[model samples]
Target chain A: MSHAEKKARTTTDEYELIYWPRLPGRGEPIRLLLEEAGASYTDTAHEKDGIQKVVGALKPDFDPGKDNLPGLAPPMLRCGDLFISQSPNIMLFLGERLKLIPGDVEINKYRVNQLVLTMLDLQNEVHDSHHPIAVSLYYDDQKAEAKRKAEDVRNARIPKFFNYFELVIGKSEGPYLLSEFSYADLVLWHLVDGCLYAFPKAMNRQFEKSPKVKELYDTVAKRARIAAYLSSERRQKYDNGIYRYYEELDE
Target chain B: MSHAEKKARTTTDEYELIYWPRLPGRGEPIRLLLEEAGASYTDTAHEKDGIQKVVGALKPDFDPGKDNLPGLAPPMLRCGDLFISQSPNIMLFLGERLKLIPGDVEINKYRVNQLVLTMLDLQNEVHDSHHPIAVSLYYDDQKAEAKRKAEDVRNARIPKFFNYFELVIGKSEGPYLLSEFSYADLVLWHLVDGCLYAFPKAMNRQFEKSPKVKELYDTVAKRARIAAYLSSERRQKYDNGIYRYYEELDE
Candidate 1:
């Protein structure tokens, strides 16, 4: 089916997700949750030059005093009259809609929120590995800085973060956090998958020490739908976005 | 109350927060949530000096083959046998406990998550302003790189994020994101408070356009409990952890 037809076949929530047409990056988690929940929504990817049009389409009526116009950045979700940006926020909205969150309202909120933060931290680390010196400078320019940042991330941050999650999983009694599959689980899986792909050598070293985290990665991967999704072409590999495969970033 | 006596009064199940004590960076949100909720929780700050002792107290023994751990990081929550970490995760967990989240599950999750991502983005900008060159170096060392980075943040990121949130508040029908007070709102208030304090000149210049965001800030400030908390010893000033005062960072 054509892309337009596929989107038409997708559910009719007033939710319009505008993101980069290429790499999954941060948008993958939200897309996966929508898929798992079988929620109908529009996933629009802007072409390299399509950002301006996308921004115009997404921004509300320009009112300097009343309306906060120009909701900057992609990976924004426009549901009905509301426009929300940021990946974790989109995931939280979709998680609740999909029942991917736990029943215990308080703890579940904590679980999802905490998981999101962990993911963001991971993203920052990944970003730093590529552009350690400055965001404006290209990877070629920041090669030396990237090498140093990569070492620090691989040595200090990765093991520490992985061990931390390993502890959290141990506290729980079941297959999922709060004893059920949560978007948080999916989010954690995505981070692991991305990190492994991006830093294979470094991850391999840490994986041996973080057996529990590796196990969590395996278990989340084994989910029937998730397994299918990974096998599908829909799941893109990292190339230019946040987590990229740079030999320098690995051990 | 003596520190130990106050610590002793905190029930094992009621309050046990595990996070690095030296930096009030990530843990601030959880602290705010607890203060607003009026819930009792221990402030188990891991000290860097007595590293071994902190590690021993913080680590959880969990089997890797059979189960998974959910988190790693300070700002972890330990209520009874359950241990949870990740700052946003802890706050969400507490959001529910404190009844700060709205009742409608979807809206509640969405709003909370949205606010949390905003917090993360704000954090990224803050970190960039400080460590524009490399995370390995201190702000004093990276001051030159930081200056360039701060220019980008002030010119692009800060306004982009603030304006987006301002729009969110504008779209909301009432005072809060979902017409009711939530943990995300508390976080937003804190972000604004911190950014304003950290970047007074930048905020005065850029924030003039985003009245909705300013209005939201004012409303959150007027909250009686929050106001009291701000006046009390619990509210501390920025210390160059996440949001720091850098004169050159402002345009």
Candidate 2:
């Protein structure tokens, strides 16, 4: 195959995503990218006995020969021989390859990365609001603290981030974070989708102040591939993962 | 200038770092990279009326013409005409330009970025441990939550991350994260150093298990430019920032 042919054919059947099964968790963003691009990938989270793939990957003492540097958590992706973890790192790699980001200008990739990183940061904040005391402990163990923390995230942080999203989307031509579709848009869409599921009342109140963000969220939902992926059996529900619904915690 | 000259001359005096004044905080990592690269950068935090520059940048409403997309927070950087925020993005740009990472291979850059992002995640966790309830609230207001959160961080999270750092550094040939000097080493070194300052007793106890991490921290501290930079007036204290030494919160 020619070099151009190789560049164009970034997606392959060999791509394997390693993450916990049963909940979409952080892996959904990666899955969204694959689905949108029609890229073939094996999501270990979905397979029978798949969680063993994730747990085994987390086993300490990585062999020096595997080029497997120790990563703290999963959502690791393996394309051919290269294995890497970290959701943003995996997104950057696949975004470039899957045509999920704009091409030609080098700096533009960093621009998309900037927005994605911000959204991911907010995602972590949302997670922490529920697990305020410790991830090692259950939500019941820190329910009181979670109540206070969730109030702050729902009242202040979400609006702050959504406004920034609205401000950024306005700078571009279309509904996407950039003028064209980028992986940042996919991540943003997932964040809003998850937020809506987790805190529907708060997000609905926030949508009033961030109509553009709400519009973009709806726009991404209607995308043919994404719509199919959302309704498919493969898409997991929000459970004990990052975005959880506890009636007491929600406004 | 020729292409070779331009490639080698990555350190332009024109690079301006925009951040808060009087505290090393998040901006210090960026400063560490610039100092190690011997890249002359104007830190907006230190100049006369410099805080104004950072404050002005934060004021809402981004201009489409400026290519200034809305960033949630700074350490915004300006190099030539390209203005960007988010510490990791700036580091990646400079890491490539200044040869901070091993060159000629594209995938290697992603590897270094992976480590840097993890360290930054720890940095945020350290910050959250202090202001557990909300970033908007004062430490005193969240003192109760902070104590519980800080204990979990000091005892569980820090060791988990430090061990991972040790594991990754062991994969390489030498003291640096990837054989030779890379930005990942600078980030890891700063993280360990900051933890030592913030949670001296805890870090000292943890260091016994993470001897390699301790060694790498010492190695980075002694690098000529870093050593010089640390002693210089440019290096700020860790007061009212991410890594704070609260005696009650420590041990």
Candidate 3:
């Protein structure tokens, strides 16, 4: 192909996402973004030899004799020559390219990043709720500790984070976090969706106190693309994902 | 002042960092960047009524009746009109202005951000060692759980994270993460310093297996500006920060 043709092909190339097959975990937010943008992408998690493909990519010699930067974990994205991990970082790259973020009027992009990081913080805490003692240990092994941790998360942390987002939405002029539908809105929707599955009773109670956040969640769910993605077969179920509904851990 | 003169003054303006008065928690990374750049900045944590200043800034009406964008927590940086929280986001803002990051050469800045976020993940895990159950609970109340959590962290997580960093260093031709001094280097130094204090025996043992990381830590400590900052009173001691030395928890 000519140089101009090559550049055009690169710009229009589909993303390849490598994540665990079974869980809609960290990869879900990225998937949501792709779905919302109606972008072309391949989810390696669902493909044949998917797990091995992910494992192979994470190896230093995946490219043979060349030491590529291996990701610490999955939910990695590849587009053209770029291979990057860390969900928020990947989201930022996609957000910029897909125009999911506002114009870079100085700190606007950083504002989006800040909110996404906060969502990640909440997600980490959510994961910790089930694996309070150690990630190496099973939830069954640490059931007592998990129960206690879940109580604190439900009673304290959830309120603090949800209220913060409520205030953010209240402060904005919109049906979104930044007065328009942005990646932060998508991230929050996925997190809240996961939380509802994980802690149905607690989240329902929390939602009662966060009307604005509840509205944002409803609004995001009703988006035509997101609505289609939610009902599609492509949307993976939450089982061993970051958010898991443990009956005893719930209120 | 004329528009040109005003613009010049804005470019050279100092920063105000609002954080908890006591701990060298998330704020340390931001401090390291300022110290390394030899930039003029005020650490709100050190001044009289410092805690109040931080508390006041977090209130929505801190600017009185006008709804200001309140930080969810501290380690917030104020430069001109921008008020941002989250340590890595703050670092990105400073990394740009202070030239602590490399020039934007495609994916270089994202690489820096990815590493910084990884460091923050490690830092969060470090904090959880002491406060396993909840941030609201006292360490004394959760000492048994803390001991168990700390043991797993010492045995598994620390080595995993340290090895990852060592591998990253080995991949680069570096005195730093990106082959030259950058904000990632500063953040790593502060984290290792915190680690050494929090789990001296464990980190000392872990260091034996991670020479490159050890070298990186030692090299960062020896920089003239960083060295000066380390010895200066401005370098707040870690008392109740993210990393704390609990004798029983340590090996």
- Which model scores highest in DockQ? 2
TM-score of 3: 0.93
Candidate 1 lDDT score relative to the true structure:
0.67
Residue B247 accuracy (lDDT) in model 1: 72
Instruction: Choose 1 or 3, whichever is better by DockQ.
Output: 3
**Candidate 1 residue-wise lDDT, A1-251, digit = tens:** 24553344345565667777678877788877776655666666534554664566556664322222234456777676556666776676666556677666544655666666676787778777777655667989878657767777888778777777665665674455546667878887888888888899888988888776787788878766678878887677677888889876786
Tens-place lDDT per residue, model 1, B133-239, is 45567778767657766776777677877777776666775466555667787788878877887688988887798787787788888776667878876565567
Arrange candidates by TM-score, descending: 2, 3, 1
Over B50-116, each residue of candidate 3 has an lDDT whose tens digit, in order, gives 8998888777555512222556888888887788888888898888787776645346667787788
Candidate 2 lDDT over B12-91, as tens digits, reads: 55788989998998898888888887787888778998888888887775442455476778888887767788889888
**For all the predictions, what are the DockQ values?**
0.35, 0.71, 0.56
Provide the lowest-lDDT 10-residue window in model 3 chain A.
A1-10
TM-scores of chain A in all candidate models: 0.84, 0.93, 0.91
By DockQ rank, best first, the candidates go: 2, 3, 1
Q: Which 10 successive residues of model 1 chain B have the least lDDT summed?
A: B61-70
State the C-alpha lDDT per candidate: 0.67, 0.84, 0.82
Error of 3 at A174 (Å): 3.2
Index of the highest-TM-score prediction: 2
